[model samples]
Target: METMRAQELHSFYGKSPVIQGVSFDLEPGEFLALLGRNGVGKTTLLKSLMGLTDGCTGGLVFGESNLLSLSTSQRAKLGIAYIPQGREIIPGFTVRENILMGTFARVDGRREIPEYLFEMFPILREFIGRKGGDLSGGQQQQLAIARALAMDPKILILDEPTEGIQPNIVKQIEEAIIRLNRERGLGIILVEQNVPFARRACDRFMVLDKGRVVVSGHSKDLTDSVVEKHLTF
Candidate 1:
């Protein structure tokens, strides 16, 4: 298990800072929850990690490689998968088609969706022919994650995975995250505002306030007072 570090990260849009000097480390197979209120730069930080934004300073390093210089596809090829907010499934594509898109980064010219994806999200197998737009919101979220899993990523950045999802489906996704970390040894950076669920699923968490990391600690060490001041909106 190697260390994953985001070192002194800073980013801005149109001369206004969005992520202000954030730093964090993720141990391999660790589950970290990124907790913050809306528009506090959580998504912007995730996008910066993918190198989609123009002016992200500092570094996102995976082992020995610096991610800041890599293009989105290059980062994807290096095993960084981002499932951004809104699920973002192609509405016109079938479930199978959408999931297969995750394989676009493969270098060996593989044309098929990897076999491990079906094992991770069995429900996707059932919905193979179904249109992604026709699925329930929870189902769409599942497909989005399954699509990311197909990329064989070392680190998965999931933004607001439980937003607008039913409770039962949320539980399923949580359990799946636990299994992935425990069994496959994948690192997860979960961007979520759902405090209770995030605390339950992640080993550690960081609080982002006004584009900066205000506090961070293990989930078990996060007290009620800490939650009220930083997590409550």
Candidate 2:
């Protein structure tokens, strides 16, 4: 695992700036939660890291590579897997195919789905032959996560993964995320709205108000006052 650093990062969609001068460091195997209200550029910051923005400037370094110079595919090959909001699994593809699709970005060029993925997401294993569109929303979210894990990434980035999920599945997903970070040692950057979960699961938390970090510290320092002031909408 390698450290990811962003210094004075700014991201734009066409000519409009959505993420303005944000900076942070994600140490190897560290879980960082991004907390904020809607449309505050949390997603944009994640996209910027993956080079999905139309344009960006500043320093983004993952390990020894300068991420700004890499294309989205290149970044994935570098072991950064992103599970965007809405659980964008290929609806037309079978669950197996969708998970295999992630292997295309693997540097090893091997397309085998790791057995551990099945162990982590048993539901996916049970529905391996089913079409992605047939599964419920929570199942699709699990599929999305399994697909990302198939890449064998060193860092996992997720956007509001538990949103709209069933309460039971949400607990499962949260436990899986914690296991991925603590047991598998996968560094994580999670954009989430659930304050209690964020406070409990993350090593550090960053509160983004308007495309910039307003408050940040160890998870232990995430006080009620901070949540009431910046997170309560």
Best by lDDT: 2
Per-residue CA lDDT of candidate 1, range 1-233, in tens? 45778988999786877899999999888999988777788888889888877688887888888888778999888888898889899999999999889877666566687676677677888889999999999999989988888777888899888888998898888888878887888999999877777778789999888889998999996778988888776
lDDT of 2 by residue, 1-233 (tens): 68999999999999999898899999999999999988899999999999999999999999999999999999999999999999889999999999999998888889998998888889988999999999999999999999999898999999999999999899999999999999999999999999999988999999997899999999998999999999887
List ranges where model 1 is wrong by over 4 Å.
114-116
Q: Which ten residues in a row have the lowest lDDT in candidate 2?
A: 116-125
Q: Which regions in candidate 2 have their CA more than 4 angstroms from the true location? A: none
Write out the backbone clash pairs for model 2.
none
TM-score per candidate: 0.93, 0.98
